[model samples]
Target: MRILFGLAVLCAVVVTGISYFVLYRYVSDVPENKICGNIYIGNVNVSGRTKKEAKKLMEQHLKEDAALEITMKVGDKSAGATLEELGLAYKDIGKVVDKAVEYGKKGRLFTRYRQIKGLEKEKLVLNEGFVLDAEKTKAVIEERVEVLAEHAKDAGITKSADGFDITKEKKGETVDEKASAEMIRKYLNSGWDHKGFKVKMAVKTEEPSVKASDLESIKDELGSFSTDAGGGERWKNLKAGVDRINGSILMPGEELSVHDTTAPYDAEHGYVEAGSYENGQVVDSYGGGICQVSTTLYNAVLYAELEVLERYPHSMLVAYVDPSRDAAIAGDYLDLRFKNSYDTPIFIAAEIDSANQMRFTIYGKDTRADGRTVEYESETLTTEDYGVTYKENKEAELGSMQYAGSPHTGKTARLWKVVYENGAEVSRDVINNSTYEKSDQIVEVGTMSDNAEAAELVRKAIASQDKAAIEAAVAQAKGMSAAGSDNAGEEN
Candidate 1:
């Protein structure tokens, strides 16, 4: 019995040793540069393959995977491009391939033998070859999806013979860039089957501020005013300024600045040298006649019953509008700013008609009571007569005189806005109080150096502070100088 038990134990031990030697030899038989049997690198079976051969196979798989189409859908609009077109390429796979090759070849002979044997029951699969640049991926996504983007359009108004034409507003659509890029990344890292992909792109909706319905009620002509659009370069400036301001829609509580809308008054912006008021004189400046446009718009706004937030009078009175009614826009300090205080939006229509008149017509919903009328009255509180001013001119012939500028009368005035209901007076409100500086009639008197007599006579005439006396003295001195020139010519 003892001898039979010993024989059974020896047979079992011998069988186990033979199996261990077989597994160890199998694991060791794999080429030094070859991956062990039953190992995969990212779904590409590299079992029993050299490192170079495994890399070649993985490169082929990467090419196919890169060629796979990635589709992004924004609503029903879809954009698609292959991963290669989107600048995606797998990171270096040499290390991962080496890792796979080293598997079942590490540790003691028994451990390696057991690993090689375990491959038959549970195959080794490695997650590799999907890393991509984040910025590059996002850039491609944005470029491809740009065509799917739509910008929101606000409702617009156009003038018509009947009333106004309201254009319909449109909603916008844009892609969610971050989420789209992340979706692709997450799928490639975990669930990618080396095939084409379809992603429902995250899209955002944009709303319009003034919907078509909101402009439906803005059809009435609230107020309209027409001023003389002056001629020449000033006229062209007026046209340019008016063109910028035309078709402007001012919503409720929104203010409009004449300077802001038509600024940077340079030749590039279509403005040329034209006459404008500076230092109590009319001088040539860029966008010179811009104030007339603002004044016209100011009157229209006043008649429309809009709120005037800022207004400034010209240095002197303008011939186009009343003293207190004119609105001047200079640099940034002076601007004709007004707000749409009505419950609805307002539209400004400006043009220089064939009659050489610049007109600004305000159109909006008229909520004023029926039979109610509005009018503005200008009252002169005080007035001062301008005097004659004489300045000496050395180059002119003796006693010759020239007018430098026209005289301006000084006045303190106030404007009143009166509301009448059913042809009966109801309320009167003071709009503004303005003061205009008086300018003297500037006359340049000649002071010829050779003629002391003529110079003294001109000086006495200027001191008299009389226009007629100064003119007579200038004429006499000019005649004496002419007579002396004629006598000298005859003697020669």
Candidate 2:
């Protein structure tokens, strides 16, 4: 039994040795620069081919990919990107090709036998012919997607010579970056079979918040106000008030308060003492000129046909606007308020010009028919002489006295808004019924010596109503009299 086993082992060894020799010779028989049988560089058969011949064969297939262009589409919109741009490219296959050519040849007899046998059953596949550069892919994908992206546009309003017009809203669309790249990847993995392809793109939609039709009716200047602007803390206060109200916007039925527009009424908020109504007297206080801004805006709101929500008439008549038309605001206690009743959004534009004029313009849709206009007028309902209050002094010219500025008359006034439809007064509506208390006519009486002669000269001059005679008497009185002096020019 041992001898039979030995003979069988020897027969097997000799047969195996012959097989190894045959495999080795087969491997060596391949041309120096040619690949072994059944070798593939990404489906491009290179077996039994020289290095130059294999590269040429591969180049023909690679040329197809080099010129490859893929269009990414979202709905009907499409944009194209190149394979080279997406970093899906093939290059430097010489080393891999050379390795495949020397596969079974560069090994021991047993190894060579196994390699040749294995190759006979399955072909050698090399993925080195294709490489992916991630950065390049990202850039290419974004560029292509951007070409198909549409940005949404918001609604807008424009003013022209004729009137105001609105711009309609526009929708936007875009592609999904990740999904677009994935689609390209699947196509690339197909051995770049199709030179050019169109991929189904993922799309998104964008909407606008404001619409043009929402502003279609805002076409008129409702109400407006203007006042004198002068340089000082008072002027600064008025300008600061205007700055606060500048570019203010309001929706339909919304109200704007004077106090809310001008807050923190102090030097810290840019206010300076100017003339203002306080306790029935014109006094200097912080935020003094700020009321003029409110007054101007109030008038603009009225002309624009907006509703007057809350307003207060000045205790003393304001000189900037017509009497009874002035809007007075005192801190938080008193405010000038108005509502945007035009059924659309309104804008406030306030400005203090170089010509000492502060103007407030109200812009909104004008629903007034053609050839229509509005006007506000102040009518003096009743008038009465201001009372006189004499203050005694110790001067010798007892009767001689001077009052500060001019005496203001006390009166009750009514404000009326007259609407005209096509050059005719259609109707008149009362806006304000204001009453003002008379400011006392102050007289400084000289009490130093009670000079009867100077008093007689003054009375004679007043009787004549002659300017030269009164001036001559006053010059003689100042030169001769002694007690109290009249300082008329020293008053504000």
Candidate 3:
């Protein structure tokens, strides 16, 4: 019995010593001392190394990751962004080390012992966490993307000294920001698996709306009209409206909305307050005298025999057009619209030059006969006129008045769409019967004092029907009286 007991005690002491030593390894191999087996920091097995040794390995890998350059392949071209430029830095080094040491050391005594042994077979991978200057990276990517992007070209035409220069449409290409950002982030986190990695960038393309070939069918002058663009803001408004409609190519069966093209008029958009007909009187407003452009376009469209979708006449007569021939546009309320009813396309070529003349030339296929022609004849049906209007001016003499403008005669007129073949009228159709309101004569009467010289000048102007002479005389009289009154009021 004594011999058997001694063998059992000896076996227990040996077993105890083996357990204590195994447990000693588990307790001592901590992040403060050394990294245990089966631990990895982003695929770099940091097994069985001291704390100092593991840091050296991780720092070297981090530096490698930071030194890598990422190539962004865009189509046939490519650009690159380096980790140093992106401000890439590993931030969770300490945390990763702590976790690596803590692994397999938790749970009860038996569980801890089991895990320490198990770690030899079960590998633990802790990817290196990092932070980056996202804004800087984004800016770098955007700049490179912009350099690689191609802008689209919109269709346009400029009148050259020869015929006309046409611009063809071009497709636009750009980088998809979201996709590129994601791919770049993933590549950067790959632990610099590649020294200089090449990644395909995401790009998008867009097509232009119009093309030069769309207007190829426009080879002939279908119809045309022109009007005198009087000077000042009124002329500017007219020119602006015409320019907006110019170079516009209409596809077959498409309608052009004048309001949609030119609207939201303001001084900010190169428009000024000019004389415009509103209600029954003339007023100053933005895009004034724009009706002249629409009126001119209407006549051209009529001669071209294009389909008129919508049109409205002004309340009063416009000197540029006859009573029944005028077309008016008032914000979004009133609009003048037309359609390209033919199978071919049409181009509206409008211009205003140094001669102060505005012209709109419609270009399209003229299917009419060689001798066939169209004409617009405005016939006066009835005529009426109101007398005159007198307005007092504090600066002008009582008997002497300056003629602001002539009174417009109210009339009922019919616009006939007449077709002439072989120089003879073959058909006549009434297009519109417009009734215009009369505009009263306005004169600024002098309120300062009566002047016989100015009065005689007015009489002579009335007799000879000279408006320029009346205005000149009235201005001279007002100047003379103003000087005289100032002299009289001064101390003598």
Instruction: Identify the leading candidate in terms of TM-score.
Output: 1
What TM-score should be assigned to candidate 3? 0.52
TM-score on alpha carbons, each prediction: 0.60, 0.48, 0.52
The TM-score, computed over Cα atoms with residue i paired to residue i, of candidate 2 is 0.48
- Ten-residue segment with the worst summed lDDT in candidate 1? 83-92
Model 1's C-alpha root-mean-square deviation from the true structure amounts to: 12.6
Off by over 4 Å in 3: 1-154, 173-205, 388-406, 442-492
Alpha-carbon RMSD, each predicted model:
12.6, 21.8, 12.9
lDDT by residue for model 2 (1-492), tens: 999999999999999998777876876665666688898887677888887887788778776676677776766677677776777655577787777778777767677767877989999877545655678866875776656667677676655677665678898865666666666665666665545888786666777655676666666676677777867667788888999988666778788898987887888988877777766566788888777888888888888888888888777766778788778888787788888776778877788877878888888767778888999999999887876555544553544566643356778999999989988999999988998777766555443444566666665664565556666766666554543344423557
Which tens-of-lDDT digit does each residue in 1-492 have in candidate 1?
999999999999999999888877787686777787789877878898988898889889888888889888876778888887666666668888888888877898878878877988888988775765677777776777857778588899889787688899999866777777767777887857878878887767778877888888787889989988768788889989999999898888999999999997989999999988888888899999899999999999999999999999888888998889899989999999999999888889989889988999998899999999999999999999988788877787667778898589989999999999999999999999999988888888877746677778887887887878888988887777677677877843
User: Please, what are the lDDT tens digits per residue for candidate 3 over residues 1-492?
Assistant: 999999999999999999888787765554445667788888688887766677788888877877888777877788888877777777778778777766666667667677677876788778787656777767877888557766566676665567667877888977777777777667656664536778788777767767777755667788888888888888888878887899888878889988788776788777789988875677899999888889888888887889999988887778887778888899898898999988887888898867877888888878879999988899999988855665556565444667765477788889998998999999999998888877878776654555555555545544553556556656776676667667878885
Clashing pairs in 1: none
The regions of model 1 sitting more than 4 angstroms off are 1-151, 171-207, 451-492
lDDT of 3 at 374: 89
lDDT of each model, Cα atoms only? 0.85, 0.74, 0.77
Model 2: lDDT equals: 0.74
